[model samples]
Target chain A: MIKLLSLIFLILLLIVGKKRGFKTFITFYLSIFLIMMYLTFMKTGLNAIFLAIIICLLATLVTLFILNGSNVKTKSSFISIVFVLLLVTIITVFIGNSANIQGFSLESIESIGYYSHDINYDMTNVIIGMYLICTIGTIIDTSISISSAMYEVHENNPQLNKKELFVSGMNVGKDILSTTINTLYFALISSFIGFFMWFYSVSFDFLSVSKSFDQNIIQLLLSFIASIMIIPITSYISSIMIMKNKK
Target chain B: MKKYLTLKNILIFVISLTIILFVYNDYFLYKTPILKINNIETTVEGYGSYNEKYYNQKITGVIKNGNLKGKIITVNNVTSTSGVNDEQIHKRSELFIKQSNNNIYSIIGVKRDKYIAILAVLFIDLIILVSGIQGVKTLLSLFVNIIISALAIFVFQSNADRLNLLLLYIFVSMIFIITSLFITNGNKTKTYSAIISSIVSLLVSFGLSYLIINIHGRDVTIWTMDYIEYVRDYENYFYVCILLSGLGAIMDISITISSSLNELIDKNFKITKKALLKSGREISKDIIGTMSNVMLYTCFTPIVPLAFLAIKNNMPLMRAINYYGEIELIIVLCSCISIVLAIPISLYISTYILKKYKKEVVK
Candidate 1:
């Protein structure tokens, strides 16, 4: 079933996206392979957070430079994305430690009940790594959109000054902000629909369900927060970098 | 003007800070008895044949709710460094505690709503500060949508045995699409065009996948899916998942194409349909890659750790994929298919609505 779906997906990509679609297909699998490699590396007891950051940087490079091609827009967006990612990473570490939301939820532990728990890796760092990886996709998408739109605005009106360009970038960000947030919100909701349904089945009370917030809800909200915080920063940085490149 | 702006900024900052501070100390808000840990004595315990190191913490704390609002309490917690099922009890951590029959208090999970509240406040403040009124509208729409979704869940839960999950979600998806676009884009022709295109593309792509799944008639084992142990009818639930998961990306593509094409026509009414289609294709090409990337990452990244755990425990990679990764893979692929299919459908619908029909009316 999976094979048939992948085949249909690939054929559709070739039909609609053509060459770029083909590149996207490759990049999609490449990212999956990269994540698998990242998880495998985590098992070797390396600094999970550090390795996550590096892998994130690599993923960004592959997605931006390779898929979008190395251009002024990709470069500036890359810089902004890296900056936002690092900032979000610091926030994740702080929240992960303070909130103590590490490890599997009680629901998840049921599935993995028979598995050995002596993997000897700190689940807190692993959780932080997961948070970082989960958020990088949206960050890249937003940053690239801002940078590319700013690039086009500059191209159409070269007379626009730095402040004007920055404001324009921000206006674009604002326009897309709602949709982007919607995308993230729905993505999070749909992914966890099963778990939510399970909660209903067990007849967990509202308060206890809220208590389960530490599991998936916290991660979802944190990602939303991270994506929201990245917008203005990316707009500002991409604008400045784009303006500076013209001089 | 600059002074006023600065003052507003300062006021927002101060308000955000106060909210964070209040949430940080909001122990009295929770109905459950809260424990503010003052100290911990940790001893390592050897467990099982593996001699795994587990920390048994003798924790003492002050109760911050109910009859023992100021009284001290003690509990024992065994936690591993991995912190999978049990967590290391940190000093200064606030916890929910329950009294056992022996009159001894036992620790529940950590009280984490304070952190969640703090993050929510920061997000709201940042949105309001940066985007101002538009941000507020976006938040309002989000709130409305969330309430709608909650209501849908409630209805579904009560009628799970009677209702077809896929049909219920289809109804929910339409409400979501219309409500979201109307709130975000307002009452414009472009918005109308987007609404029509999104609904058409959603139904078309969803119908295609539904037909394909029915033809392929292999029953998916729901036991491998996370947190789905309670679900009885996997087929309907599986279809619902595909439909709901793909709805976002499809709507995103539809709106992007429709809005951009409408903008193109608005900019130059004399533009040809061919030109509009070309431009729509160009925009679709740019967005499709990243949009589908979003689907891929969002759908698949959460399973990385679980798959890792399975593989690390000597489960074969193929077995791990079969057990845990298959459903997510199908979801992402189906979403990507809808995203791909949405591009041309939206382009054709938008171009025809904005150009051909409008031109006939103008003539």
Candidate 2:
């Protein structure tokens, strides 16, 4: 019953998201395959999964009011979504499959309480979520802001040429870039205020503390670099897209 | 008369003099001890009482400074009659004692002085210097937020677990929304909507987290000491705190969406839901992307020490990188989940609130 309700809730979420054109219905369908993969590891058998998959397919069609790829203009996004789901399944399989661990289910459930004993560093979903969110946010901001600045520049001087428009964007981007960078920096500082205080309290040398918190630093570096990299790429994407959209 | 005493110059002169007086008072105000810059005992070797031979044996103390600082002061043949354990013996050592020179004493603790008068003068000076109404609003909001966070941590978030701490942060956000909106817009229907919208979004965000954790298998144990610290069922508690930590980002997004949506409606009541939502989506795409990175880096910065470790050791790139993937996963999941969750929840609540006060929109 709990599983059924959760499924219903997920469906509702999809419906709501689709109604607003946010495009998370793909995430919903992908979730079904994930659920199946999870059940397969539970030894629910391929027969039950086949039945479940068929039923889910029909339900998804009924909800979306069409079957596979009906509204897809470019097949690439569709393929990308499929690829992501496939990747998730393949990873989960590698992590939990092939081993004849009968008590795996029990361990997984027991670990849900504290996750202390059996929970290995299986943080794939979470890490991806963070990276996507940060990267996505920064990308949108840079893209749209640069695009807007380009529009203004082009509009002001209609025959200013493409190179001139590009320069204009670089100029405007330069102005607001520092504030945005500072904002992220200060915000990052705020999040680690507690950790810094603790670090200061403990009399560990800089090296020891650095080693102790090695993972956090890497994650930060990755996310920050990702965001940093996205700024120029997104700015370029928006610039080109806007230029193309105009032409 | 105006030339003899200009208000600006007098004020500046008074402020400078006041600061000088305070400094002068600190240096020479009271008969406080002029403790010499003697060496401080930075390192100590504690001998266990079980090592009875070394227990009372006088070892010269090494100091970092003054003449006697590095010089060892060995107390000869001190005896410990109390047979405590070795650790206790080190802990209970009477190392600090009052030593007098020239009828003055160097004590083992800090000197105390109340600086309330200086604080009061500063406070009054701020008011006198900047008495605009906008300043008052800023000050009030700052005070309110400080109080709310304090109350939440001390009163509400009594639990030590980080996950529970996360949950508590969400609840505290309610106060943040209510107080900030009230301060800005006053107690009106719009501000009311802000609070309502905030709460609904928070709950929805939490729901999304539930789905991510349960269905998608987002391991909440990716957070600080989450899996390793437990001898019991602490994962749930850890989840709540992480949920809390991620709540602020969601709250920030929700408020941004709501305020913008509200303004759209106010500017032109004829604006359709589609238009309002479109504006919000346009705004959110930028916010969500930046916020996600913001959230990612926020979690990442603290764990920076962890990265240096990877660099210091000749560890393989794969091995060093693996530790972060787990933590990175949590930061990502929570942030994306927040971004995904906040939009729907804010829009839905805004719609409902708009429906309720369509009549009140006039007033």
Candidate 3:
């Protein structure tokens, strides 16, 4: 029954894509298949995080190519986003370790073993893995947006100096920054309403809950802070690189 | 604007009153101390100790709601093994009660809904102050999403045997997409583009996720998360979680792409179709980074700290990765996949629709 439903949904997706043209329909279909193939074929091992990152990057590459064609400028922006993600991933690991925010805290759940009890899950690596995986999408998204904005600005006024073009890129980045942060914040807050409810229901006073510094809350704070921090990095990098390429 | 000020002031006043009442209720609102605190203090000092704890505070209060109203009750306000205070009961706190023969009532647990509601209100107030009218609409949509989700859960609980849960989720996802986009955007070309793009992106991501789950899913079983054992159909819970998690981020990206495309098209009607398509792709590049980052951070919020805990426990890297990283990896990947795919999906759909619209205008 589930299989039939899914097949029906896929058919609907294809039908929708067909209206746009064969390129739209085919690329859309292939994108879905490509991602699914990565998920199925990848080995679940110590390097699983890296594997997932690479697959996601590949998917993004394919996506960018499909939408924008194989432009040198687009490729450069993609590289820049991946570079930033690597840097951010390193920083996230450092923060995660020093903060000691791992494991199922007594606050969030009754047990620590989400997997089999006999298995000793490498939770530190898991933190690193999750961080890296989560970071890729945002980094890729931000890089593309900044790069795109810079290109558009340059296209509109071809005579603008590199410095001026860089400024325009910054301006576009600024506009995108505020809204993106709120989207992250609100989405995070809303998704975990049930968790908050649990805390309050257990009669955890505001002070206690805030002060406890549980892994769950720390995770949110870390993700929230790290995500916001990446914006300027990607924006500036993409802005400078795109502007410099203009010369 | 002045009327808005009055409304804002009233909200502030109400919030202040609640805080005051909360403090008063915990301390001096009702002076007759029906329940006394059995303050038992204990201290255990050393490495890995539970904070050299002290003082278990047991307080008794009268039942103020339901059939047991006006009954005296005894409840633990705090349970501490060392000098540290573990938890505190507040004035607006609600409790579950058990009735014994002699009017002696035992507090079962704290009722959490009221407190959650209060926190939710605080969140709503903040949104209003920050975004104004749009914030209110966001809040309404949020309320609707919550209602629909809650109803779905209720349905799931009541009729797990009767329904194909996956279909129900797909249905709910459609409602969520339509209601969320329409409320925020009204009926516009941009809104339709966002809705179609988001749904298509979601389906692709979910389809891929479904395939991944079937092949490499044994290690990351449903047992790893909370609320599974009690669920009859615990197997589908993870998929449901993935589906729900991606919705906000996917919708967000689609909306960003569509809005940008619409703005660009409106500004440059004379631009060629090729340029428009190229520009749409460029706009997606701008959106993909921050939007994806928003998604990553949202998923990372709770999991990062848990990673830290494993480190503290001296859990080996490979083992920790195997146990914790595996499951979290699947989740992050699935959600991120949706977000990444959403960019192009939105770009292509918007480009095609806007091109058609432009040609129509020319005729």
Candidate 4:
């Protein structure tokens, strides 16, 4: 039933894409296959990883057809790449068929293990979901919009030097940066406000409490630092990438 | 430094901070104390002393309709926890409660180097002030996303059923995308293009992630981290959830970068389709540069605590924190796979958005 709904959703999404003038029907189809294939075939080991990468690259080229269905230029190299990936994947699957696929067992039911008991992880994930779904996603979207403004500035006036366009992009990025970062920080705060309460409620001595996890307050401090670190990094990366095209 | 300041920027910072502070104050700082001694009923002899007011507080409580209605007392000392230095100590003292039984619980705060707030303010101020209208749109979208997340836990996502958990995430995700894209692009053909592109990119990442994890021997239950504690023990929901979670951000980034590039090319008739596609691919390589790390940093946030424990115990990096601790492994692999998938997803979506947009203009 889940599968049926997802399939229907995919179909509906594709039809909508068509109606809206965005191509990608076939790529969309391949993605569905990829999801199923992964659930069925892949593992996280090196070999499984290699297999998945092959499938993804091959599938992406096929997406070109989705974008411009028929009567479109087909890059020969792209086709060849897909063919080779398929060939390799088939061979690997045959060779690596020894992986045990056990039927659902009552034993598998008895001891479901570790995470089934972690309170911290549960609460953290709710926040993480918010971060991923909203905060990070928002920043990225704004980055794109900033990039658009830059792209427009450059394209409309090719005379604008690379530096000017870069500046323009930066300008737009700067516009989004403040609220975007605010949103990010606030999201972090709200997510872990409990941790703060835990921190303070027991006399600001985070040392003993800190010792309880593989990660501690220091790590939280660092990761939050890292989150801050991404702001400049993303901005700079986009700016530099655009600058390279000009040179 | 000064470039980040302005009334509008300051206003944004001040507003958000003020709101955060008010909420923090009411929730964490505000206090109401109600104290009671085990056998100390109403004082008979000190009734006159209670009226002689050294009390610093106004206290009110009532025994409802039955009999204690409108029983009110104006107080001085709360529950007598306060020390009395009086040589002529009042024979009877006003009694008060330190905290009421049902009143909200509150806690003291940690003192940080004050620099943190300044940095955050500057950072936020810079974003809202610089982005102008777009900044506001992004900010509003962030709030909406929070609401969506809040609902995901209580209203939608149930770790009890792995399948429902997955669907719930996907549904919430769609709502998030629709909200942000609509806000950022406004109502137009372009917004529609961005939406289609965004969805396609997400699907691409999802596909590749699915392939990698299954091929790699990841246990579905492994992804739920520590589920039995929070939701239910048998929940295999997170195996799918974390991957989907990672996919959303990566997908969002890819579509965004690609669409912006497409818009650039569209504005310039000279930028041919091949050039545009090449540009998207090239830009993706650059996005991959840091984005891969972003994924790592993202994974680090939760598992960082685990890593800290490992380090303090002098655990070897591998065995110390158990990098592949089933849950962390799920996150690490999921984010990594999603990061890798993001590249092609962005490329494919951008190509489609631009080409299709071109076709529509012609039609």
**Every candidate's chain B TM-score:** 0.92, 0.57, 0.78, 0.63
Better candidate by lDDT, 2 or 3: 3
What are the lDDT scores of the predictions, listed in order?
Answer: 0.80, 0.41, 0.54, 0.40
Per-residue lDDT of model 2, residues B156-259, tens digit only: 32345443554555566666666755774566665676567667766776676566567756433344432232212244443544455555555555555666
True contacts kept of each: 0.53, 0.03, 0.08, 0.02
Question: Model 3, A29-124: lDDT tens per residue?
Answer: 454354334333332323435655665577567556665566655776676667656765665566454433333334445444442221123344
Interface RMSD of each: 2.0, 17.5, 10.5, 19.6
- What is the TM-score of candidate 1? 0.95
Better of 2 and 4 by lDDT: 2
Task: Give, for candidate 4 chain A, the lowest lDDT window spanning 10 residues.
Answer: A98-107
In model 3 chain B, the worst 10-residue window by lDDT is B79-88
| Every model's DockQ | 0.60, 0.04, 0.08, 0.03
Q: What is the lDDT of candidate 2?
A: 0.41
Best by lDDT: 1
Docking class of 1: medium
* TM-scores (chain A) of the candidates: 0.93, 0.48, 0.72, 0.40
Which has the higher DockQ value, candidate number 3 or candidate number 4?
Answer: 3
DockQ of 4: 0.03
User: Lowest summed-lDDT stretch of 10 residues in model 1 chain A?
Assistant: A203-212
List candidate 1 stretches off by more than 4 Å: A203-206, A209-212, B1-7, B47-51, B232-234, B356-363
The residue pairs in collision within model 1 are: none
Q: For residues B1-363, could you state the per-residue lDDT of candidate 1 as single tens digits? A: 676578778888888888878877877676678888898999987664334578789998899877779998789998986766678877857888888766698876787777787778878887887788899889988899889988887888787789877788899999999999998888877787888988998899888888777799755675666656655455677777888887777777777787788777767888988999998898889888888878777777778667767776888766776678788888788888999999999999888888855532242
Q: Evaluated with TM-score, which candidate comes out highest?
A: 1
